[model samples]
Target chain A: MELLKERIRAEGSVLPGNILKVGSFLNQQMDIALYNEMGKEFARRFSGTKISRIVTIEASGIGLACITAQYFNVPVVFAKKHRSANVSGDLLSATITSYTHQTEYTVILPKAYVRPGDSVLVIDDFLANGCALEGLVSMIVSGGATVAGAGIAIEKGFQGGGDRLRARGVRVESLAIVEALEGPEGIVFRK
Target chain B: MELLKERIRAEGSVLPGNILKVGSFLNQQMDIALYNEMGKEFARRFSGTKISRIVTIEASGIGLACITAQYFNVPVVFAKKHRSANVSGDLLSATITSYTHQTEYTVILPKAYVRPGDSVLVIDDFLANGCALEGLVSMIVSGGATVAGAGIAIEKGFQGGGDRLRARGVRVESLAIVEALEGPEGIVFRK
Candidate 1:
């Protein structure tokens, strides 16, 4: 986690409107080595937990979930996000509001993938407003599965999403949590 | 490659409109073990090639690219698909028409990631009309990088996308090439 925090301090730029762009290493252009390290850390954190499946939202979260799933030895089921509210009986869908795009999109997972009594561990790149994570948790619950907590790479603590989930008894683990992002003083990590 | 072919024949379903759904393993619900094997095969096929980076499109391709990148020991850069044409000067954008979705979207890759003299290996889950692959190749070329061929998990050979790219002198190695999709007889693979 220190390594990730350091990398964020070195390369991450704070854009206007609370956007922490770690696109250089975390999301867009991925560093697989770092991803492996993060995966190992995630595995260590949730070692004793029963994680039957690793679920994530599409696009950025897919790689991290896939790499991290290798350590857990579990299959990763990524929910697909659609711009429209198209749903079917065969699929479990949830509507999520994106803090970045300011849009509401529907995220869906096929019913056949999530089975009853499955303990799902949610993995994602950034946890800001927690809407995406909340939507994934709802889908897992709807499918008669248990929430096995979440492993996030970065969390904006100032946004208060992770704490809200923690208050609700959801074990959310964020590798790098930015407590504050000052304009001239740079990023401040959660100590 | 044989393992991948076997998986397709056993689990892949031929949905209506010539759609081969291998979501159970390759994309939606990912099998990490199989992905590791496919990654090894990709490294073997492109063994002597100078692959500085592995490029792929977002969502499905991210997992595959990241898994395969471990074998190549190179970074993975995934292009993000946006509904609108909101590209900037720092990004290389391409317009691609999806054969499945029947919609056109803009795929953008950061210019900073693809450097000049870099040899990029394009990785994707499926290749149908080659529009997505072509767009990715153009972006790599636009950034002055050389295409060190592509490594695809599945190619609908009947769709002619892989063949078209091969005809253009690009080295495309698909793990499983589907020759035909007979509804009654099941899926057929190229020998």
Candidate 2:
């Protein structure tokens, strides 16, 4: 986590609306090396949790979930934001509001992917309002699967998504948590 | 490649409109073990190439590219399908037609990610009409980067995309090449 925090400080930029852009290595463009470290950390944090699969959303979370899945030696199932022709069969769905894109979209996963009694670890790049995480967890629950926990690369602690999940008895682990941030004041981590 | 072919025959399904769905392992629900093998094969195929970065499209390609980047010890820069608020700065863009989705979308990558003289390896889940690959190559070329080669998980050989790219002197390595596929005839692989 120290390394991730340092990288964020060195490369991350603070924008309006309390947005922290770490596109250089985290989201738009990725640093596989940093992802490897984050993967190891997630694996370590969730060790012995009986994780059967790693679940995530499209785009940003795919890279982190896939890289982290190698450590768990499990498959990754990413929920599609939109229904496509390729995605058929019965699907578990949840509607999520994206604060970044400012739109509401349905996230779905095939029922066959997550069966009864299966344990799933949800993974994503950022957890701001926790809408995406909540949507994924809802789908897993609907599929009769167990929620092992959630693994996130960066969490906006100020937004309280991580704490809210924890308050609801969901185990959430984030590599780096931004306790506070302002455009001119920079970022402050949750020590 | 034999492993990949076997997986396709066992799990891949033929849908209407000549679509082959390998969602069980390749796209929807991914098999990390198989992806690791694919990554290793890609690295071996393009081992000596000077690949500074791996470029891929959003969603499906991110997983494969990120996993493959580990072997190359390089970063991955996935083009965004939509312009998000987080994605800032000048970007190189290309329009792509998705044969599966039956739509066209613009793929953009920040100019900073793909620098001049940078050697890039393009990775994707599937190569059908080669529109996506062509768009990615154009973006890379626009950024003044060199296309080292391309790595695809499955290539619809009957579609002629692979052959066209090869005819243009582009080095394309496909893990599994589906020579033919029909509703009742099942799937056939190229020998």
Global lDDT of each candidate: 0.90, 0.92
Model 1 segments more than 4 A misplaced: A83-89, B83-89
Worst 10 residues of 1 chain A by lDDT: A82-91
Kindly provide the TM-score of model 1 when superposed on the true structure, using C-alpha atoms.
0.96
For residues A13-37, could you state the per-residue lDDT of candidate 2 as single tens digits? 8877777899999998899989999
Candidate 2: segments with Cα more than 4 A from true spot: none
The CA lDDT at B21 in model 2 is 90
lDDT of 2 at A141: 93
**iRMSD of prediction 1:** 3.7
Considering summed lDDT, which 10 consecutive residues are worst modelled in model 1 chain B? B82-91
Which is the leading candidate under TM-score? 2
Question: TM-score for all predictions?
Answer: 0.96, 0.98
